[model samples]
Target chain A: MPGYRSEHIVSSYEEELTQIAQHISRMGGLAEQAVASAVQALLKLDHDLAKQVVAGDKALDALHRGLDEMAVSIIARRQPMASDLRMIVTSIHIASDLERVGDMAKQVARRALQIEGLSLNPRFYNGVKHLSDLILRQLKGALDAYATRNAAEAIAICNGDDEVDALHTSLFRELLTYMMEDPRTISQCTNLLFCAKSLERVGDHATNIAEAAYYLETGKQLSGDVEELQRVQHKI
Target chain B: MPGYRSEHIVSSYEEELTQIAQHISRMGGLAEQAVASAVQALLKLDHDLAKQVVAGDKALDALHRGLDEMAVSIIARRQPMASDLRMIVTSIHIASDLERVGDMAKQVARRALQIEGLSLNPRFYNGVKHLSDLILRQLKGALDAYATRNAAEAIAICNGDDEVDALHTSLFRELLTYMMEDPRTISQCTNLLFCAKSLERVGDHATNIAEAAYYLETGKQLSGDVEELQRVQHKI
Candidate 1:
């Protein structure tokens, strides 16, 4: 009878864990859509779509709050130990990262709204679009790695941050050159610069999630190679 | 004898709580010094100080990790509930914010290094200097509020973020005009623009810590007023 009772308790605990994981996956989906919509809004200069992206961030925030509350409540009730505790804590971390990703998307959308009707250089917009696509891929990869507990994939996504940083530097230089060549392009180029920055930050948040996934799987931090990348990126 | 034993346990628990609070305070002090030093480096073009700020960020990161580990360990071992759990969780949040504050300082320092020989406009430098001063004040106030568990002071700090936003907008406009007026200033002005942005982000982190402080005290999130302020700031 005791064995059966323990099994029942374990099954309930697993159910709660599954629920939290589902919430994180749902939140990730919303963040992905937010980024996609915001970038499309920027590229098309669609004020309405940008507005939608801004509105969509609230849902992501709500989901994050709900997920955090659930995770904390489970911790308080279950008093999970070792790996279970790490998973719960890391869920909170991932939710926070996803929420910030949503905020970055909103930032990009706001920039789009601000620069509405200003014809920017197509090359600059194309560069930012390409960067956003790459970040979105990283975001998805990180989330998938989390779902599958694939630390190798998570580390790969984390390492991919160097590419984003490189692209951001190039975009920054290109924009500065454009503004120097045509002073009239200063305002629009500045807006694009911020857009690129938002995309770069999205990459950072994706990397953060990748790190969280690695920690969740191994119960250890991925420090060495990632710290080296950060040092190199910091020089600029 | 039993009463004495329980009282001793309570005291030990309180001691653990105090230790976590002390770590947070130490981290906050370091972050404040970092921003101040980084800005001074930028103003004086002091390369050594800039490098110091960059190197000092690792200490802040270590403190953040230690605090988080302590907090999570307490949660798992002690299984704190209600306000105690909230306090522990919020400490982790605040530590994360302070660590990011260090990163922003590092970013400002890197910009200082990149524009080492260029002479930027005095007016623009003064504007950035003034903004940094305000943000540092806010950082101090937020930390003080957290130490005291004073929700009122925290809300005040949170409300102060609007001023930083307004100043950032103006500084951004001024820098853009400077770059447009003199193509030769583009590189320097771009660096200054990032400095302003880093300072502005520091303000956001302060506001985040303030919000965490309020939540720790009240066990409730201060969402309504802060969100309203964010909306007003975003309209710009």
Candidate 2:
């Protein structure tokens, strides 16, 4: 009878972990949607879409809170060791990162709301469009890495941030030049700069998730040292 | 003798928690120093101080790693419950916020390094200086809330972020107007804008710490609603 009860407890523990993962996936979906919708809203100057993206942040935050509570319950009830413990802890960390991603999307959506009625050249939106797309791809990969326990994918996403940072800097300069050329466009361009900065932060948060994902899957930290990371990335 | 041994273990556990608090204090001091030094470096264009601020980030990061390890060990060994569990979890989160504060300071310092030798009008740096100073005060209040377990201070720190955001936006406009006045200052003005943005983020991270600190002290999440938050502030 005792053996039967122990096995049942084990199965239920596994079930709880599954539920935690499902919560993460749901949050991930919302985060991805928020970023994509926010970017589209920005590029298209669609106020309705921007409002939807802003409103959608609440759902993501709710998912985060749910996942966090689930994590703490699992940790307390199961007192899981080693990787199980890491999984629960890492889930909490990753949920916070995803929540922040949604917040960044909200910031961009707010900017989209502000930058209405601006019919600038198609060229002005091109860099931001590309950067937003890059960030989306990075975010998706990081989430996939977390879900699938793919250390290689996580490391690649981490290394991929350099490109994101570079693009952000280039866009910063490009926006600066535009503002200098046409003082009239300064307000609009400044909004774009803030949008670009938020997107840059999204990439940074993705890097953070990828690193934590790597540790969750492999139970090892990504190196902070540039040379060490370079070698690891080279190998990967 | 067995009872004595059991009591000894309990005392040792309490001592370990004390050590954790000390680690947090050290981190708080480093975070405050990093922000102060980075801001001074930015305002004065002091390259040496900027480099020092950047370099000091590594130490803060090292402390974060140490705290994380300690937290994991405590959780695994003690299987802490209720407030005890929250203290460990909250410590981990606070360490992260402090680390990010250091990261934002490093961002400002890098901007300072980039803007070397451009002796502009004193007014150009004034707004940035004020913003940095305000952010530093916010960060200090948040850390103090954590260290002292003061829920009221935590609430105040969270509410104070509006002023920080308002100042940042104003500075954003101020810098834009300056750039518009003189195209030659666009690059430097852009740098200032980025610095202002970084300081603004420091305020954000500090607010995050304060919210988490509040939960650690009172076992309650700050209300996300403006009305509820206003009610709580009025009570405080």
Candidate 3:
């Protein structure tokens, strides 16, 4: 019976890993949709789309919970080791980052709803739209890198976050300048500032996922000093 | 020999759990220190202390790595199930949040160094100082709740985050209003906005830790819908 149980666990190990990967893909797709819809909602002040983005977070949360359960169950049941364990561990971190990305998008969508009734210059959003576009690309790249196990692309996403940060800082000043120049626009610009912040955080989450992917593929941290740790993992 | 091996694994299980708990405490302590020192550095514009806060993040990072290694090793070697496994898993998450708290404080300290050359009225920091005070208390409460396994306190910490969120928004407006009133104050207010934002994020991270703590202690999510899942864990 003990031998049979061990074999049974081994038989399903690859299936479980594949299921986790597929779940990650689905979650990434959902997260990307949330961020994309949030941008469209903000740009068009589309009430229905904003509502959908806000409501969509529940699905992402459910998926996050599912992924956590799957990871924990596999680890506890199969007791996978070395690379398998690292993959499961990294997946948990990546899923956590993706969940936060959903949260950021939800915040942005809420702000869009907040400023829905206001009449604003489209020019007001060009900077924000630009930031969102860059973040969306970064997010997409990160997801692709994770799926394909492209450590180079993952590293690129991490490095590209600085551009996102610089853009955000500049946009911060631009939004505040609008408030300063036209006191009438203060409320709108304040909401816009928060939206910009949400977008910036999405970029941060993307970087986190990329870093996690990088660690998964390389057994090394993007920030270094992980070589020794990998040795320990192997020894254990 | 196989029986001897099983006995050895069981013997070290408690020690491994204790080590993880102790590691979490140390990481939490360093996180609190980083936040406290960052506040002091910002209030006094003390460059040395700001540098110290920035440098302190490395130690927190090291401890996070150590905790992860310990958790992974125990799980792979001992293959602990049930509550022992949950404790190890929760410790990893708590350490991650604590590490992020350190990162937030480091950011605030960096802002302190950025604005070190500016001469300004200390009154400008009154709102910021108050916000930091609230955030520090929340972070400390969260750590203590986790240490004591007080799920009620953890839930209270989660509820208290709304106050922190509201305070951050008000401070955001307050700082922007200062900029509008005097364009000359824009740069200073901008930095203050970022520092305030960092403090707000610290509050958010505290809530995350509190939620994790709640889940670990109760085997249920603070936000509910986890009863079925605990049943699943028990079945596993």
Candidate 4:
């Protein structure tokens, strides 16, 4: 009977862990939707859709608060040690990253609203669309890695950040050239620059999530490879 | 004897809390120094100083990790509830914000390096210097509020973010005009725009810290006032 009671306790703890993981997955899904909606809103110049994306951020924020509170409560109640503790702590970290991703999406939506009614060059629009598509792919891949506990996949997603940075740099240079070519395009290009920046930040938050996943599986921080990439990009 | 033992436990808990607070203050000082140095580097076109600022971020990152580990360990070992738990959790949040503040400073430093040897308009330089000064003031005020557990002071700091946003918008417009007026200035102005954005982000992080302070004291999240301000600015 004593052994049976111990087994019951173990199962209960496992249940709680499963619940936290589910919450994180749900939060990731919401963040993914937010990013996709924001990008589509930008491309279609849909003001209503942009407003919807902006309004959706509150839900993401609330989910983050809920996940954080749950993680803290589980720690206090269960006193989870080692891998279990790491999982809970890393969930909190990933939730924060997801919340920031939501904010980035909202910023894009706001920029889309600001640029409404301005006739922008189609090439600039195509550049932003392409960049956000790459970011969205990174976001999805990182979330998948988190769900599967795949550190290798997470590292791959992180390495992809260099490509995102390179794209952003080229887009920035292109937009600058556009503005310099015709002063009339300055306002629209400026808005586009901000949109590009928001997408770039989304890629950054995705990398943060991937790093969290790597830490969760290995109980170690990812090395300085990403930082090295950032430094190299900065030099350029 | 029981009463005395309880008092001793309370004192030790207070000691742990004090230690965490001190770490946060130290981290904030590092972040403040980094931002000031980066901005000075930009104004003086000091590549070496900018490199120093970039290197300084690793220390901030290490401090953040130390603070986070301490907070998590406290939560696990002490099983703190109510205000004690809130304080520890909020400390973690504030540390993350400070670390990101350090990143923004590093970004400014990198931009300074990219624009080396280019003579920018003195007006633009003055504008960036002024913005950084305001942001640094806000950061210090927020830190003070956290140290004192003064929710009112924290709220005031959060409200000050709107002014930062307004200053950033004006700076953006002015830089856009500069780029338009002289295509030769495009590269320098673009770099300046990024620096302005970085400073603006530092202010946003300050507001995040202030909000965490308010939450620590009141056990309630600050309302949507800051978000409302953001939305209004987006409309502009």
Ordering by TM-score: 2, 1, 4, 3
Candidate 4 residue pairs that clash: none
TM-score of 4: 0.90
Interface DockQ of each model: 0.70, 0.66, 0.37, 0.46
Q: What is the Cα-based lDDT of residue A233 in candidate 1?
A: 50
Error of 4 at A143 (Å): 1.5
User: How good is the docking of model 1, as DockQ?
Assistant: 0.70
Query: Compared with the true structure, what per-residue lDDT tens digits does model 4 show for residues B89-137?
Result: 7888899999999999999999999985776577766877789999999
Q: Highest lDDT among the candidates is held by which one?
A: 1
Clashes of each: 0, 0, 0, 0
lDDT, candidate 2, residue A209? Answer: 89
Q: Which lDDT tens digits does candidate 4 get at residues A1-236?
A: 99999999999999999999999899889998998899899889899999999999999999999988898787767877757877887888889999999999999899989885766578867877788889989999998888899987888888889899999999999888887777777777778788888899999999989988887776677754566445544654
Ranking by DockQ: 1, 2, 4, 3
Candidate 3: lDDT of A18?
93
TM-score, model 3 to reference: 0.87
Best by TM-score: 2
Error of 4 at B72 (Å): 2.4
Model 4 residue runs over 4 Å out of place are A1-12, A117-123, A224-236, B1-13, B117-121, B224-236
lDDT of 2 by residue, A1-236 (tens): 99999999999999999998888888888998999999999998999999999998999988887786787777887898877888888888889899999999999999999996876667668988889999999999999999999988988899899999999988988888887888888878888888999999999999988998888877777855456478776784
Better of 2 and 3 by TM-score: 2
